[model samples]
Every structure is written in C-alpha cells, then in structure tokens.
Target: MDTLELQAKAKELRQEIIKMITAAGSGHPGGSLSAADILTVLYFDKMNLRPEEPDWTGRDYFVLSKGHAAPAQYAALALRGYFPVEELNGLRKLHSRLQGHPVSSKVPGIDVSTGSLGQGVSVACGLAKGLKIDKLPNHVYTMLGDGECQEGQVWEALMFAAHYQLDNLTVIIDHNRLQIDGQVEKVMNIEPLDKKLDAFGFNVLLVNGHDIEAIQNAIDKAKTCQGRPTAIIANTIKGRGVSFMENQAGWHGTAPKPEEAEQALQELA
Candidate 1:
C-alpha cells in the first residue's frame, strides 16, 4: 500500500478501536492507539498473511507481546477479514471469543496467547528459530511496550534472539514513554533503549512509530540484516489520534466515559 493509503487506513483503524472500546465499555485504548500505525503497516502492507487461512504455513506471523492492546489487533484482523467485523462488539463480554487479552485458540488469526507482557518476544524468537530450522522463508514480527521491557524475561528473550542470530525476527517496541501507572521515565527510566538493544547485539532502527513510510523502510532494512536480531524502537504517543486522551497516562487502561467517547469519536470523524 502507498503511504497515504496506509495513513488513512491507520486513522480508520484508530477510530474503529475507539468505537469498539466504547461499545465494550472498557479496554486498553491508550496502548492500542499507540500501536495502531505499526499494526496497520504489518496487516495492510508488510506481512504476507492469509486471513482466511490463519495457519497457512508459508505465511508470515505476528505476535502481540503487549496483549492488552488486542483490541487494536482485533480491529486489524476483523477489518482484514479474519472474522466478521460485527464480532468486535463482543469484546471482553462474557463467553466472548474476544477476551481482555488475545487467546490463540479462540481467535483465528492470533499466533499466540498474549497479555502477560515480556513473553511474546520469546515466543516470536522461538517461531523464527523453528522456521529457520525448517528452511521456511517466513518471518516473525512481535510488538512490545517500553514498560514491558522492565521485565527480566524480555531481556532474556533478547539475549536468546541475539545468540541464535534470529535474523528473521523483527521486534517493534512501542515507546510511547508511558505505562499504566505513570510516565515510563518516572516509573522506570528505560532511556538509551536503542543503545541497550545495540549492546545486546541487535540491529536497531529508531523511527516515528506513526509514520508508515519510516516503518516500512525499517522493516525492509530488518529483513536484510544478518548475524543479529533487529529491533525497531517506535516512538509513539499514548492515546494517539484522540485529542483529550493523547499522552495522558490515566487513559492507559480506563475506558472513556459515555460523553467522552462520543466526543472522541466525533473528533476522529
């Protein structure tokens, strides 16, 4: 897809996220919105996915490590025809396939069950290693939040990926600089993140998370990288695309009030 098309689609996806969360009455909108652009590029432009055949062996894979943002992933999957868009209304409802976090068994396109942060990258690395061993050309892409990096398991996964030279694995970090509690800098300063990843033997590419062109270029570069895993540090804004919610840490896990949702939707329109 072209840059303009990707941007428009991302905007639409952001609106869909807001609408779904509003209908459901609760969700992690802030993170979801922050990661929408990266997901847009993956689903609409980069990844070679088969929506109808979610388990297609030759297809590329995506793992949402920060699973609370599943709403955004769900939006992408539904819009891409993995399931009927109507099912999005069932998000987080009793007995709904769309749980608070993604469940691989229930969701057709989900590659892994995620929600507990810091584990998705490990799973992605494993998948990449397996594919390499099988001689498959497919790639594995995983998204992580900056706050999730505070977990020791994430670093362990990074070390493993680097040690294995998982070139087919591309890790995207949604560095919105905010977490559930407060600003990431104040909560746990993970600054110089690019340097840290580089020291761990990763080919790091820093870019504006919301820029489609930059994201596409970075993914392309990662694909050609050799002897190391690639990490794209995507600088983003919490609650992106919504005026009142933008950069507000309080919105990290809170659903907008009825009036607020209405206003937010109006602004999106």
Candidate 2:
C-alpha cells in the first residue's frame, strides 16, 4: 500500500481498537492507538504473512512484546484477514480467543503469548536464533514499550541478541513517553535510549512513529543491516489520533466509554 493507503488502514485499526475496547468494557487503548500505525505498516505492507495459513513456517514472525496493545494487533490481524473482523468485538470477553494479550495458541496471527512485560523480546530473540540455526531466510520482529524498558530482563535480551549477531531481528520501541502512572520520565527515566541500544550493538534508527514513510524506510533499513539486530525508536503519542485522549497517560489501560468511543471513531473516520 502507498502512504495514503497505509494511513487509512491505520485509522481503521485505531477505530476498531476503540470499538473493541469499549465493547469489552476494559482494555488498553492509549498504547494500542499509539502503535496502530506501526502495526499497520508491518502487517499490511512489510511482513511476509499468510492470513489463510497462519502457521506457515516460511512466513516472517511478529511478536507484540508490549502485549497490552493486543487490540491494535487484533485489529491488524482481522483487517489483514487472519480471522473474522467480527471477532474483534469479542476482545477480553469470556471465552474469547481475542483476549487482552496476544496468545500464540489461541490467536491465529500471534507468534507468541505476551503480557508479563519484557519477556516477549526474549522469546523473539530465541526465534531469531532458531531461524539462524535452521539457515532460514525468515526474519523476526518485536515491539516493546518504552516503559517496559525499565525491566532488567529487557537489557538481558538485547545483550543476547547482540552476542548472537541476530541481524534478522528488528525491535521497535513505541516511545510514547507515558505509562499508566504518568510520564515515563517521572515514573522512571529511560533517557539516552538510542545510545544504550547502540552500545548494545544494535543498528538504531529513530523515526516519527506515526509517519508511514519514515517507518517504512526504517524497516527497510533494518532488513539490510548485517551482524547485529536493528532497533527502531518510534517516537509516538500515547493516545494518538483521538483528540481528548492523545498523550494522556491515564488512557493507558482505560477503555473508552460509549460516547468517548463514538467521538474517537468519528475522529478516526
């Protein structure tokens, strides 16, 4: 898809995210909205995926390391034809495959079950190493929240990726600068992130998370990088595309009410 088309698809994903979260009565919307463009570009334009064959080994893998943003991934999966779009309304409901987080066994397109924060990237590192062992050309990609960077395990995973020279791996950080409590800096500063990643041996690229052209270019650059993993620091807004919610940390885990959802959907439309 071209830039306009990708932006439109991202709007659709954000709308679905608001709808599903409101229907479920509780789920993360801020982070989900922030990551919509990144997910849209990945699933719709970059990744080698088979919606009809989710288990296809030849396809590239994506892990939503920031699992609370499952609504965004679910929206992307449904729109990409991995499952019925109607299933999106079942998000976080009882017995729904579309839970609050990406579950590999339950969800068709999810390659890993993620929720505990900082662990999904470790699994992604394993997948990259395994692909390397098999001599496969497939690549592995994962997204992490900037707040989640405070976890010690995340650093360990990055160290592992660098040691193995997993160039097939691309890690995108949704640098929205907010968490549930407040600004990420106030809660726990993770400044100098790009420098840290570079010190860990990653080919780091910084971009505006909402800009499709920049995101596409960064991902393409990651693919060409050799001998080390590439990390894209995607600077974004917490609740992007919605007027009232944009940049508000309070929306991190709060579902929009019906009226709020209406306004957000209309804005997205």
Q: Considering every candidate listed, which one attains the maximal lDDT?
A: 2
- Candidate 2 residue runs with Cα over 4 Å from true position: none
Model-by-model lDDT, in order? 0.93, 0.95
lDDT of 2 by residue, 1-269 (tens): 89999999999999899999999999999999999999999999999999999999999999999999999999999999989999998998889999888888998988899999999999999999999999999999999999999999999999999999999999999999999889999999998999999999999999999999999999999999999999999999989999999989889999888999899989999
Clashes of each: 0, 0
TM-score of 2: 0.99
Candidate 1, 211: how far from true, in Å? 0.8
Tens-digit per-residue lDDT, 81-115, candidate 1: 99998999899999999999999999999989999
Clash pairs, candidate 1, are: none
User: Model 2, 110: alpha-carbon shift in Å?
Assistant: 1.0
Instruction: Please provide the root mean square deviation of candidate 1 (C-alpha atoms, Å).
Output: 0.8
